[model samples]
Target: MIYFDNGSTSFPKAPGVGEAMANLLATSAFNINRGGYAGAYRVADMVLDTRELVCQLLDWDDPKNVAFSGNITQSLNMLLKGYLKKGDHVVVSSLEHNAVMRPLNQLAELGVSFDAARAEVDGRLPIERVEALIRPETKMVVLTHASNVCGTVLPIEEAAALCRARGLHFVIDAAQTAGVLPLSMKKLGASAIAFTGHKGLLGPQGIGGMLISDDFAKELEPLISGGTGSVSDTEFMPAFLPDRFESGTMNLPGVAGLNAALQYVLKTGTAAIYEAEMALSGRFLAGARALPGVRIVGVDGLEGRVSTVSLDFTPAGLDNAAVAFRLDSEHGVMTRCGMHCAPRAHKTLGTFPQGTVRFAFGHTNTAEEVDICLAALTGMIKGS
Candidate 1:
């Protein structure tokens, strides 16, 4: 089976990911910072190491600024809820995922408003477009590093610089680009970045985090206040970097898997992985474009995109869902169809109401797999 739905969740997670989780689950049953025992200390060390590993991957200086959460959704919620107050304004891109839209939408009831800078048809957002949306009350600028629906890389650095110049905080949702792209807080000039482990990071689900700059971390409040295993004497939640945000028991097993996966990603290097996936994506795009009735979405080339490629088959009078079903059932090629949780993105791409079928490549996918998928798409079109 060819797995092409890496955008949803990566398949065949890094070699030791599962083993790492299983090892932690089987041998350790200790809660971090709960007690002064060998097992607890060991678990605490693992958690710290995982945070440091994530920091290293993102080129962050302080691991303590990395706060673990259940997923990027939770991280975004924490950031949005903590940072934004009523009567505050922010700017977002047209290609933002629902994760960003939903939370901000909920905040709108309380007076937070945001404007979406129109993204280019090719899925790139220009800094000028974003800057034009800024208002007097604009407190921040949030953008997706890459579009999950169309795989277009946004202008993160340029937009971040705009935010900095305007005295607004810049937050990036690196859901699609985290492990696949070389991310640096200094390079991107981002005040904060939210990431998930299951996708490009090649780790298990239920574990992800947000990396906030020192100053930004200080201003943000914890979404949930509980026993942070620190400052136990007082009922008040600890006001430290991570302890301030991490209020509940940590997901130790997930952190173990993330630790192992981070090691794998660092050792393998994102540059090599990105090169390979782009090669596959370019191959698939080249072959698919040759087939009649296949409409390639987003950028035509790999210059400003990741490995994901969305195809619209309606030109051939085929339903995107039906096409995806056949690709999985008959062609043994798995893919995700419909809006991919980014309805606004689909609308921006002119594939709204009826979304396109997405084929997202991963680190383990190859050119041969791309050929097979291209051939399968041809068969589907011809048979129709």
Candidate 2:
């Protein structure tokens, strides 16, 4: 089967990811920080190493600032809910996923409001549009590095510069771009960045985290408070970096998988991965552009985008769901269809109600698979 759904989660996770998790479960499986035994100390040390690995991947300096959570959505919620006050305002791009919008909506009910900097029909957000939305009450600006539905890369560095000049906090939702793109927390000048392991990181599900700056970490409150296995004498939570946010038993198995995956990513390098996936994407885009009734969404070419590509089949009088079903059932070509949990992005791209079929290529995918998909799409259009 040809898996083209990497935007949702990676398939054939990085080498040794499964083995790493299984080894922990089969052998040690001891909880960290609570136990005083040798095995527990060994496991805790691995966890600390994983945090350092995350910092290395993101070009962050302090390992203490890295905090793990259930997923990027949870990390985003913790950052947004814990930082914003009732009278504060925020600025966000129109291409954000539900991970950002849902939490902001919840905050809206509590009088914390936000303004969306509109993106062009092609899914690119202008830097000036973001600048125009900032007000005296705007305390933060959150942006997705790329669109989940259309894969258009946003002007995050420009936006970050604007935020820095204006003295506002900057945050990045790197759900689509984290492991795929070369990102540096220090270079981007972002206050924090939320990332998931299951996508480009090629790790197991249920583990994700954030790399936060010292000042921003201080301003944000802990969303959950419990036993941190530190500062046991006091009832209050610890004032340290990770201990302040992490509570209760952590997902040790997930961390094990992520540790192995991060090693693979670092060894292989993100530039190599980007080149491989974009080669497949370019092949698909070149072939699909010639097909009848196929309307390519977002940028027509490969510039300023990731490996993901979205196609609107409405011009052929075909339902997007029906097209995706045929690709999976007949051709064994897996893909994600519809809004992709980012309705605001669809609205911005003018594909709102009908949505589109998303083909998210990965480093594991090959040019031959792209050819098969292109052929499948051609046959579907001809048969129609």
Candidate 3:
């Protein structure tokens, strides 16, 4: 089957991901940083190595600043819930996923307010527009590196600079762009970056985290207070970097899988993977745009986007769900329909309420698969 929903979660994960998980589960089930036994030390060491690998991939400075969680959503919640307090204000992009919007919404109920800068009809969020929405009480600016629905890459560097100049925390949701796009902490100047290992990192699910700057880490409170296996004498949480945010027994097996996946990504190189996926997506876009009823959303080219492409079947008087169903059932071409958990993104692309069919390419996908998908789409549109 041809999998085109990598934006949701990567399929056919890196060859070693499952192997590593199995190996860890079989060899050792010990928790990290919880004991003095040799098994515990070994697992803790591996976790630290994984943090260093993450730092390398994101060009972050200190590995200790990276905090692991079950998923990007968890990481985002930790940051949002910990950093923002009552009476604070925030600025967000119109294309942000519910991961960002939901947490902010919860905060709003507690008296926090947020403004959303509208994206261009084409899905670009201008830096000046974001600045215009900033208020004296605006404490942070949250941006998604790329829109999960349309794959429109935002100018994160400019936005980060604006936030830095205004002394507002710049938080980046790198859920869609982490493994596909090259990110540098030094270059973007972001205060925090939340990422998912399963999506673009080519890792298994249940492993993701956030990388925070020294300043952000210091001021941020812990989302959960429990045994970090450190400072046991006191009831309060540890004041250290990672242990401060990490509580209870960590996901050692998932971290092992992520370690294996990171090794694969580093060896293969993000630039090559991105180029290949974009090529496939570009071919798909070219064919889909030519079809009478298929309307491509957002940018049709690879200039400022990832490999995700959204299609509207309304022009052909076909149901979006039916189109996706045919692609999976009749053609063995898997695609995602509906809002993709990003309602705001759908609204920005003018496909809200009736979401579009999304085709997101992965590193393992090929031009041949793109051709097969185009042919399947051709037959579906013609038959309709």
Candidate 4:
């Protein structure tokens, strides 16, 4: 299948992702820091290497500050639930995924007030609009780096700076932009970043992480309290940076795969990947806009965006699920068709009540695939 659903989880991951996971499961099955033997210590060393690689990727000075988690959803939950007290205020955006919105929504019932920055009807969240929503009581500013459904990249650096200048903690969800975009934790002024390794990172599922700043690392409480490999002597979670946040036996095999996947991106170069995907999406966007029944979402340009682009064909009386089925069956093109778990974003973009068809591009997608998808879509529109 010609997969264009990388915005959800990158399919057919980088060359070494699966191999690395299999190799680790077969050769290095020992628990980290559990035994003094070489087997256990070797596993621990690999995990440390993964942490250091992540630090280098994000330009973080401290590898100890990065914490491995299950996914962005879990990391967001841990941060939102752990850090926010009963009365803390948060600043969110209308462009947020449910991963951020759900927790904050639940917290609303518990006396946590929030202000959501509105997005333009085209899905862009202006920096000034977001800045205006920051109240005096806002302790945390949470936002997505890019729209998972529409590929509109927000000004994360500006949002993070707004939080920093106001002394509010900044949290970013980099589910769609981690490997496809140039982002530095320091440069972006983010206190903590939740990432999904399965997406742009091209890693396996069940393994995602967060790169936390030293300041936030020290202050953030452990949301999931359990047995960390370190400090087993006490019931209290260790007061260390990563150890405090990480609990239970870690996803060592998944981390190993993630390290390999990240290595692939580093070698292939992020700029090259971004350029390729942007070109692909640009071709699709320009072509779709020329079609009669096709309507594109997001800004007219691909600036400040990843490779994802959403389109609306409901105006032609086509059901999203039927269109998805036709594309997968008649054409070999694969795409995600739904609200994409960001109903609030759809509401902001004026696509709510009726979700749009999303076409997310990956590094492996080719010009031929784009041509084929456009041809199939054009035919569908005419036939409908």
Candidate 5:
């Protein structure tokens, strides 16, 4: 299949990812930070290795500040719930995914307030608008590193600088750009970054993590409360970095795979991946531009985007879902349709409700696959 649903979860994972997971699960998968045996310690080392890779990818200082979780959703929850409380004002970009929106909406019931910065139809968020939204009551700014719907890369550094100047927490949701875009947690002055392991990171679905600065770690409350391996005797949750947010048994095998996937990303470098995917995306947009009734989204210069690409052909009266189903069934082209769990982003781009057919590219995609997608789309048009 010509898979293009990578925005949801990356397909064709790196060569060693499956091998690493199998190696651990077949031999010695153990609950991390819980067991005292040497085997458990060795298993825990894999988690540390993954965290180290994440730190290096994001240019973070200490690896200890990274904490493992389920996905970007859980990581965002940890950061949002941990930092914001009653009456805190938060700033969010208009391109945020449901993960950030839902939690903030729920928190609004407790008298918390939020102000949304305007995002252009091209999916880029204005740094000035985000800064302008900052008030004395603004306690945090949560924004997507890139729009999964349109592939627009937000100005993380500029926003981070504003947050720093105004003394507000700068948090980034790196779900779509974790391994596809370059990041510098230290240089950008980001207080925290939440990322999913399954998408651009090329890891298994069940594994993800969040990285935070020491100050944020100190002030951040624990959202998930329970046994954290350390201070097991105490009913109170531990007040440490990883132990603070991480609770319950960890996904060791998935993290083992994550370690290998991150290794692949480092060996290849995010720059190379970005260039490759941009080239592919450029090809798609170019091809889509030539066709009649093909509405291409996010054709902005390769400078401010990730690998994701969205297009619509609703003039043909075949909705995104119908086109997606046809692509998978007849043309062997797999893709994601509909709002993609980001209705607000779609609405901001004026593609909400009806949504758009998405063709999210990845490192493994080739020129031949692009041609296949183009040819398949053309065929779909011709057959109609």
Candidate 6:
């Protein structure tokens, strides 16, 4: 199958990811921190190595501040719910996925409020508009590094600078840009960055984390309270970096797979991956533009975007879902259709209710696949 749904979850995950998980389950799948044996120590060491790898990838210094969760959704919950109190206000972009919007919505009902900096029709969130939304009570500014629907890379660096100058905590949801884009926590001056393993990281699902600064880490409270295996003597969660937030037996096998996947990403370099995926997107865009009645969503060019491209076939009298169905069932081209869990983003891009067909290319996709997809689209449009 020709997979163009990498924005949802990467397929054919990094080499050795499956093997690493299998090896851990087969040989030494011991619980770290709790188990007091040699196998447990070895597992714990691997976990530490994984944390350090995350730091290396994000250009962070403190491995201790790295905290893991089931996914970025959970990580965002931990960070948002933990840090923001009843009176706190936050600033966000209109292009946020449900991951960010849902939590903030839940917070709004509890007296915490948020404002969305409007994005342009092409899905670009301008820096000046974002600056205007930051109120005196705004405690933090959260931004998705890129849009999941249209793949428009947001102005995270500019927002970070704004937040830094205003003394507001800058939080980044790097769900879309983590593996495909070169991100430096030091350079961005972000308080925390939440990332998922399954998307751009090319790792297995159920493993994601956050790299938090020391000051922000101290301010954020733990959403969950339980034994961290480090401080079993007391009922209170340990007042430390990771143990403060990580409560329960962690996903060791997922961590193992993510470790292997991260190693592959580091070796392959994000610059090379970005170039390869963008080349595929560029080809697809050039061909799609030539198709009659086909509307390319978002920037319509390669600038300030990732490999994800959304198409509106409404002018051709084609249903988005129907197109996606035919692409999968007939042409063997897999793409995602609908709002992509970002209603706000859809509204911003003016694709609300009637969502576009999204084709998200990955490093594993090729020029041949793009050609096949283009041919499939051509045939569908011509009623052949």
Q: Which has the higher TM-score value, candidate number 3 or candidate number 5?
A: 3
lDDT of 1 by residue, 1-384 (tens): 999999999998999999999999999968998889999899999999999999899998788989999999999999998889999998999999999999999999999999999898778787889989898999999999999998999988888778888889999999999999988987876888999999999999999999988888778887888998888999987878888888889888999999999999999999988998999998998998897877888999989999999989998888899999998998789999999999989888889888999999997997888898888888888885
Taking the tens digit of each residue's C-alpha lDDT, what string does model 2 give over 100-193? 9999999999999999999999998889999999999999999999998988999988988998999999999998988788889889879999
lDDT of 1 at 294: 74
Predicted structure 3: lDDT? 0.90
Candidates' C-alpha lDDT: 0.91, 0.93, 0.90, 0.86, 0.87, 0.93
What C-alpha root-mean-square deviation, in Å, does candidate 5 show against the real structure? 1.3
Clashes of each: 0, 0, 0, 0, 0, 0
Please, what are the lDDT tens digits per residue for candidate 6 over residues 35-114? Answer: 88999999999999999999989998889989999999999998899999998999999999899999999999999999
The local lDDT score (0 to 100) that residue 319 gets in candidate 2 is: 88
The superposed Cα distance between candidate 3 and the true structure at residue 103, in angstroms, equals 0.9
Arranged by lDDT, best first: 6, 2, 1, 3, 5, 4
Give the per-residue lDDT of model 4 (tens digit) for 1-384. 789888889988999999999999999788986788999988888899888878777778878888999999999998898888777899888989999999998989989989889988777888898778777677898989898878888888888778878899999898988888888987887889888889888899999889888788777888999988677889898988788889989899899999999899888888999999999988998898877766687876878777898988887767777888899998877888888999989989878878888899998899889999998888888884
Error of 6 at 332 (Å): 0.8
Predicted candidate 1: what Cα RMSD to the true structure? 0.9
List, residue by residue over 265-367, the lDDT tens digit for candidate 3: 9999999999989888888888887889677888878899999999999878888999999999988999999998888888888887889999999978988
TM-score of each: 0.98, 0.99, 0.98, 0.98, 0.97, 0.99
RMSD to true structure for each model, in Å: 0.9, 0.8, 0.9, 1.1, 1.3, 0.7
Off by over 4 Å in 5: none
Off by over 4 Å in 6: none
By TM-score, how accurate is candidate 1?
0.98
